[model samples]
Target chain A: MFKPELVNTIVDAHQGPDGLLTILHAIQEEFGFISEDAMRQIALRLNITRAEVYGVVSFYHDYRTQPVGRHVLKLCRAEACQSMGGDTNAAALLARLGVDWGGTTADGRLTVEPVYCLGLCACAPSAMLDGALHARLDAAGLENLAQEAL
Target chain B: MRIYIPCDAAAIATGADKIAAAITAEATRRGVNAHIIRNGSRGMFWLEPLVEIVTPQGRTGFGPMTVADVPGLFEAPATHPKAVGLVEEIPFFAKQQRLTFARCGVIDPLDLDDYTAHGGFAGLAHAIKLGPAGICAEVKESGLRGRGGAGFPTGIKWETVRTAPADQKYIVCNADEGDSGTFADRMMMEGDPFSLVEGMTIAGIATGATKGYVYIRSEYPHAIQTLNTVIARARQAKLLGADIMGSGYSFDMEVFVGAGAYVCGEETALLDSLEGKRGQVRAKPPIPALVGLFGKPTVINNAISLFTIPVILEKGAKHYADFGMGRSRGTMPVQIAGNVKHGGLFEVAFGITLGEIINDIAGGTATGRPVRAVQAGGPLGAYFPPHMFDTPYDYEAFTKRDGLIGHGGLVVYDDKVDMAKMARFAMEFCAHESCGKCTPCRIGSTRGMEVMDKIIAGQEPEKNIALVKDLCETMKFGSLCALGGFTPYPVLSAMTHFPEDFSKAAIKLAAE
Candidate 1:
């Protein structure tokens, strides 16, 4: 989706071995996601094969092969969160949205995911809605928050 | 200068991003230049929203910051009015050894210069100078044990792999860390990716392995992303390829994401996952050291165990061996979560008591309720009451008290929790998550859940109670690995420790 010049600019900034991932991330960020063209280009530029580049992308869970929604919702599934009825809350939310964790909704309004912990154990149940934290939530709390936020 | 803000899930949950926004807005309102770089968390949760101002004195720390405190920070850039002193001086970070987390929060995570300035790969440089035997001897002398569940001696394990005859060897890091209330690995990897990379490289050097893989769980996306970035960076720098640091030892690493399978945290299963097969744990007569990863010798290690190696080299093995009690040696990074007020990462030597940690350092629960049980380790770990609070938190010390030191995750729960429900939950969790590779874990867990249900239901009264206890005994002895074996810890501990709760819940349900 990037103009050829923007991609070139990002590729130029991608320097050094230590910042290789950051450079690739920058390329992806500029184009909304890493395109096959960019991956092939990176492989050619770095003197690595396309298969090797694809291997790195496939190995990591965070790398998105497909473009995602604008807003992200990550619910905590750590013990603290689970102890505070996170299981039930998550089930209800998933049921309501008809989208599982790591799946984008049909409308592309949200992308839901499960994170290990948010370290807000004092608050028990917690979730990040579009990079904002809402803590001490129950099934009702989650429902209301997700509904109102959207 | 651009100010970096932590966007790690933990920091964001504690409102770190908002604090960054507040600082930027306040700086704008006051006509000051402020750029925000959203990075990973600093590993300390209590000091979350932990903002750093890069000054003449280095990155000055201000923590547990909310948006409300932004006004005060903008007024004084060097010495913030609301900053909680310097992060270095703070006891949470200062008191203990931070070998694995050395460069975390102290340097720009993506910036190699900052990493080098903070003494990042000096250990690798030293390892290269000393060579494999020296590195092996150094680790063996350090008395470093696996920080994961087993607490096996790391040096011996590496030596075994080093001596083993195989055309291809592998260094597999078990990052599928599914332990509850433990985020130390995630935090460490996110904040300081280089330390893990350095540790893995050291393992490769010691064992003569050319390739490495970190099998991280799918649940931790941010950590995966961070590690991927760092690995690419290392490979690009020629530090991960054909000749690492010109030492003529080839090493490369790649991440293999696990699909939310708790049992995959076990080493063999992790290897299987790396091979692009279903994650099924293999039995250990040969051990992974002998026959592993396409029948090649493999050096499998937990993230913490791997990360601790650089320190063993940087400081002498004797220095590392000088800390802790009994067989458990060196400093441990204790992660206290759930209900605790001052919940954060506390790195302490082995001998610290559970009581001091929960009451003093944690400041008890945020709800101000009386803490009933403390689940040490993970879901499979023992639930200790106040009486056991005096017990020491270490590997061998915990075993003496019939408890586990699993990944050092201490989950605190209040008085309102029902032990019967907790016991049932444990059985249910085992039944749900068990990989079904072995018969005991597969069938025994399901049986355990059903019996626990009968006990709660008061079906046949005394008979059901006896049956549940007997089932727990069967699971403990008959299971192939720790999956089904350790599930009984929670069930039995809850029943033995809090019999009153179970009796009341059962009786109440019967009456109803």
Candidate 2:
């Protein structure tokens, strides 16, 4: 549900090959997701095919087409995290929350997603809630973090 | 009094921002005249939210701080329960040979004067006098290699870009630190943004590249924000942009954010992403040095590689060449992470052995269990058993052991770790992040996963292990980029080092 004025505003701020990434980032920043309407409009303005826009949106993990919940919790599920019981901790957190990977809570307050890494491997089992990274996470810490988001 | 609190993402994640705010509020209410400096992390991650008070003895450290610790901090800073003594004197920090990261935790990242006061722009200022070939020769003599895992000589890469005839050349810094255990790039960007700026500026002068681009990953929002802020500040101060330092040579840089593709860390793929395309690998022969970033001659380097330039220029090539073992010269900002007791950044000369890093610098496993293995480099690096701990950290040394010093990310694993699952995770990671441009990587990684699943399931174990080995070999030589080529390192290393874990009777699979 991107407005025509927002599309015009985004397009006006950038130029050339760099414009696509800049525009996509601007739209994502303004709204949580890049909707089909937004993608179509981007293709129209940038003079590219709609298929190309969708290809980009689907290719990158960060470019989500659907709207996420109020708070996003990205748990690092990479090797470093795995070395420190991140998998077990994540499974327990998910079980307690009663949601699967990429699922939002029934209250619409929180969404849980799996990220490869947050670059906080030193303090393994790292997580990012609303883009703020948390380190040395445990089951209790995860619960507290979830509660804070609520 | 001046108090320093890290505003880096890791610190903010652990409530450093809240602690900073609480300290400000409490200090004002208590009539304490204190100036707060939001600096970068000292790379000692565990003690983060690490508060430091400027004292006669230097910055006294206190941390793993919280909002609740603020009032107590003001009451008795030195004797507080969290106080860990001077930041510099801490055994973890005192031993580091931090050439590139020297100013990270020491200065306000955005303050140009502070940066300059602590030897900022000295490299750029030095490069301005050397001209192009002279600067390239200096870098060649420094014996620096790419810190982005490839270990290519930095001087040769610059010389190729310098000698190449092009109307418009470009300098590209690969800040896509997608490896699981790596954060050195993030630390450098967040802690000392100006060093990168200065280093990149030096590249522009050396290679005759008037424009530069830093392709940072989307995961590092804090790093992106810091780099952007400092870039603008440097421009205003004329350390960047038109006629820098009145040298009549012009250079400018912009930060380009990548949407989350592991392959983008590869130079060619990064160049493609910068051009607003899906991040995919490009074949090389006419390497990125001769033709990169919009088809002009480009000097592509990792964040650490470029960040090392300023110090090289400032201190002279011989000074930097003096450190480290043969061939693999200079200090590596080794990121010791995973299930380790002293997990943090330890920048040291390249000759140190793995045993010293794990047992000495990192202090072994955080779980207090005996360390079973360690994965040096990134996801693509081979896992090393305790028996191989004597291997040095030099690039050639690691290569000799069928390992790599990729990005110098060392992830320690305790005895509790299941090698079967670790191997599977490697394949799963490759499958998830593969660009699908190449057949062996795209298909072989998936096939490898299935084979690993069967081996862990105790289904035709001998046959499955052989099949997995075959798949790995195919992916090793048949794939397009490092993503496909290096995935074998982890899988094969796991199989070789911990064969019992993959035995038919072991049957250890990760809980799905």
Candidate 3:
């Protein structure tokens, strides 16, 4: 729920902050993701429509309109990662988790999202579980890491 | 005082942590006044584990260090020390025209005062006085182009978005620098997170948008951490909140980590991924200006493009614009990668020939072999032979010679490189990275790969060669985005310049 005062504050807040990315991030943090109420509040506050607010939320990959899991499992899919079998490792992990990217596990313990490079070129096939790095991973290594999460 | 050590993945791969640990243990053993702070790298990668002592002058350097060398540092072991000598006089640091990269490796990345002391907020301070239109005009006059490959005029893009009527506007910085043999963006973000923040803020002011996003590749974990730490500090300082500098200008940014997709480096594709889509390229009639990031006016600039804006605004336009030759105005941060000695970041002005950079600055191949083809930009960039080594490094000149000045990444190959294999790699890269947006790119890339396979196999080699050419031509004209369009440059350039390599396959096939 977004308060009228918060809406006015957020709208007043929107003028100089680029568009609404920071507001959306804040809102997402507060409510787990961008809510219809938050969008409407932003629209009313900024003198725009709900569609406008929703549009901003949906445009950038950073903004989440839906709730993610407790821990985010981000797999590296950049070129160097691919050269080290990132695709195969990702597929094997996905099969074990039984969910596609942006999909959280049934127990809500983990969410798998595909990520680009983690900048570990020399040590390839890397992944980030939550915010920590795991490098030079084979499929078995990733599954072992995934089991720890389970 | 805490001695900063970079264990960022790049530095770790090069053994930064072990040296840092060794230094700490050595310092404790000697009961000296030193503690190690595992900081992000300064981006001068050639100097890994580049230890800096807090001298009264500044942070001093001694580098490419190992754990064995750490204990020796206390007793003065650097064959070439940074602090003892004029730190600024080092040829690597001295030769660079670091506008965007000005503060990198010079200060504590998390300290706001450290940033300000090193001339960090001067641009933001100056920009606040001039207003949005004034900032845009200054950038326009500077003739600063996008440094993240395309080299389009940054000022013009800012002006268009500044003037464009919008209910909402956005500034999206593309930090997805997937091009191989390039590390400037990563190095900058890790070394000088504040500069990028300052640069993005300047863009936000110029574009009249209240929000910004940095779509950094997930590969840059150290950069991400440094940025996150810096953003928190900036928010606390009221520099990035509701009213920046009490100027009624509000611009805040959040970093969005990208899933692996080289195609996402393209502006439209980046926009799509930002919107939580599949990172696919879109047709540009709506051209991110009129309709971008949620179908609103958006200023999508590369990391280096945004990074250059603060300096352009702080210093006058003419002062900034007076750096380079015609049309290719301002400095280019050339990234020297792959099989070259003295390989690292070399930010120089335009009009410098390939030979001067590669042969003189880089000192030729690392393998002690005569250099053959030099690939500028990245894998998608054209490979030039020894004859074209004198070509000037600029957008117009590169285009004139049927090549590109993409992202300033120059990957050198020795005489041992098979140009034919290199050509096949271009096709293979396109096939793998294509977003499957258009037939010519998606379908044609696979065909191109198959055709290259046939030639490599010597199966109807002549027919395969013609097919590859035809496919490249079709992909050039017919692809929806640059993924297919520019793939031909590497393919055809190899075909024309390295005729003997491709022809040998046919001759070998005839003999069979």
Q: Score the docking of each candidate (DockQ).
A: 0.17, 0.78, 0.09
TM-score of each: 0.83, 0.97, 0.79
Candidate 2 fraction of reference contacts recovered: 0.78
The DockQ leader among the candidates is 2
Better of 1 and 2 by DockQ: 2
Chain A vs. native, model 2, TM-score: 0.95
Clashes of 2: 0
lDDT of each: 0.77, 0.90, 0.77
Model 3 lDDT, full chain set: 0.77
User: Which ten-residue region of model 3 chain B has the weakest summed lDDT?
Assistant: B77-86
Question: What local lDDT does model 3 show for residue A146?
Answer: 83
lDDT of 3 by residue, A66-142 (tens): 77888887886644355445677898788878999789999999888876455553345667776676765778888
TM-score of chain A of 3: 0.82
Model 3, B1-512: lDDT tens per residue?
Answer: 45767756667656676787787788889999886665556555556657776667666777767677677667864454433343456676687787666666666677788888878888999999988998888888899988877887888898889999987898998999888667778877877788888888888888888888899875676787888888888989988978999999999988877755688899999887777556779897888877899898999988888777777777778877888899888888788766665566778888899998889877886667888888887767888898999899989899999999898877777787777877887888888788887999999988888888788777787778899999989999999888899999889999889988887777887887
* Cα DockQ of the candidate 3 complex: 0.09
DockQ of 1: 0.17
Off by over 4 Å in 1: A1-78, A83-123, A128-144, A148-150, B1-4, B35-42, B54-63, B76-83, B509-512
DockQ winner between candidates 1 and 3: 1
Candidate 1, residues B323-435, lDDT tens digits: the string is: 88888788888888887777777778899999988998888875689888999988899999988999997787788888898998898888877778778878877776676
